[model samples]
Target: IISVGALAGMFTMMVTMIYSSSRLIYAIGRDGLLPRWFGHVKGHLPENALWTVVLIIAIMGGLVPLTQLVNLVNIGTLIAFALVSIGIIPLRRHQAFNNEGFKVPGYPVTPIISFLFCLLLMTQLSVETWIMSLIWFAFGLVIYFSYGIRHGHVAEKRIE
Candidate 1:
């Protein structure tokens, strides 16, 4: 029973990740970071992007070790959370949200502490994981600067 429950949970997580990643790839393709072929849709579904994501996921699963994959997910999650926490400062200053009723107890200090802790946690991860993440990020930067900056929808609109 426990094994079945764990398998079900893993399946759900995989499905959720696939859907989220496919949507992100679709949006990036739509914005011109990737070939428009990836953005092709059929009946409101990003089928091409979905296939791309699936292929990438399969490749990673086949090539990358399980431990490395776990570290990748952990590091990515921590980085995202830290960035979000740090972003709260600018967001509050800009009055991004209208939440006047309830408030965090520590305010600015809380987010700062959270960001610091995330950094500390990241230091515990393997250097290989960090290097792999950096390589992927650099690749993304290259794509964005090369294709996205020139052909993005926003850039096109700005020029018009």
Candidate 2:
């Protein structure tokens, strides 16, 4: 539907995702949650990983429109956020858990704000976006429950 310099616009958007996502993955690696080698690159040379990310992005973008891709990512991020928020209430309350680092500026309020934000975003999604998001989330949920949930430290803590 978009006719004016669409390729350039989408490429610009893709760069944003690429940069933010790479930094996120690097952070996870630094925290020892993901593979340390991801953060072990020569001054942010997850350069190799970026190539893989670009290849996948090209494949996905080639197959789907930019709008759809954005919506799908939104859905995935929303679900991820929901799961993490759900964790805080129970997990962070434990006396044995480490309580280092910064706390929320306002107890309960910050989470409520975030929940509303996600809900607002979900509301903005189109029908096609909702469907695609459900499909992607379902696939990820299946894998997480089958593999990641069983192996994850957070999951193990929840079980204990």
Candidate 3:
């Protein structure tokens, strides 16, 4: 029973990750940050992006050690959370004032605390994980500057 339950949970998490990653890839492709082939849709689904995600997952699963993969995911998630927590401050300040939406109870303090905690957690990750994450980020930066910046909708709007 315990083994079955664990398998089921793992399967569910795998499916969720695959779906979300595919959607992210599709969105980036649709926004011209990635090649258009990834944006292809069929039967109301981003089939190409889904397949791409599946292939990537399969390759990683086969080539990468599970512990390393887990660590990388942990660091990546922590970094994303930290960025969001820090980003909220600037976002709130830059946006037009509106009292109509949900507000953070402690405002800046809450977000600052959240960001600091995330940073602390990230520091606990292995150095290899940090190096991998930094390398991936650098690659993303290169792609964004070389192709996405010129091909994205924002660039088109700017030109017009």
Candidate 4:
């Protein structure tokens, strides 16, 4: 029963991750950071983006080792968390949002501590993971500069 429950939980988490990732892709595509076809809705779903995500996951599952994939996911999540933690400092300084939301208790200190912990955890990952991450980052930078920068919503807003 315990094993069954664990499997069920893992399955649920995987589904949730796939859904959220597809939504992120859809949002980026809608904002012109990717091809607009991914933003198209079919029966109120971002069908193209959803399928694309599924396809990518399937390919990765088939081609990549499970441990490597897990490491990549861990490092990616850590980096995102670290960036968000550090970003809060600037956002708070700039007063980007109104004071309606829950405030951080220690302000800069809390976020800085969180970012440092994330960095420390990231450093524990394998060297291969770091190499893979750098390659992926480079690919993203290329795409952003070559296409996304010109076609994205921010650029459109600037043109107006």
Q: For residues 1-160, write the lDDT of model 1, one tens digit per residue.
A: 9999999987997898899989989988887878898789999999999999899889999999989987887898899889988988776665545768646569989999999999999999999999999998899899888887887776533311
Which ranges in model 4 have alpha carbons more than 4 Å from their true place?
A: 1-9, 155-160
lDDT (CA) for every model shown?
0.87, 0.70, 0.88, 0.90
Instruction: Compute each candidate's TM-score over C-alphas.
Output: 0.80, 0.60, 0.85, 0.88
Q: After superposition, how far is residue 70 of candidate 3 from its true place, in Å?
A: 0.2
lDDT of 3 by residue, 67-114 (tens): 998887788778889999998887777546564586777998999999
Residue pairs whose backbone atoms clash in candidate 2: none
* Candidate number of the best lDDT: 4
- Model 3 lDDT, full chain set: 0.88
**Model 1: what TM-score?**
0.80
Judged by TM-score relative to the true structure, which candidate is superior, 3 or 4? 4
In model 4, what are the clashing residue pairs, if there are any? none
Which pairs clash in model 1?
A: none
Error of 3 at 102 (Å): 2.6
Residue 82 CA error for candidate 2 (Å)? 3.3
Best candidate, TM-score = 4
Model 4: lDDT of residue 47 = 97
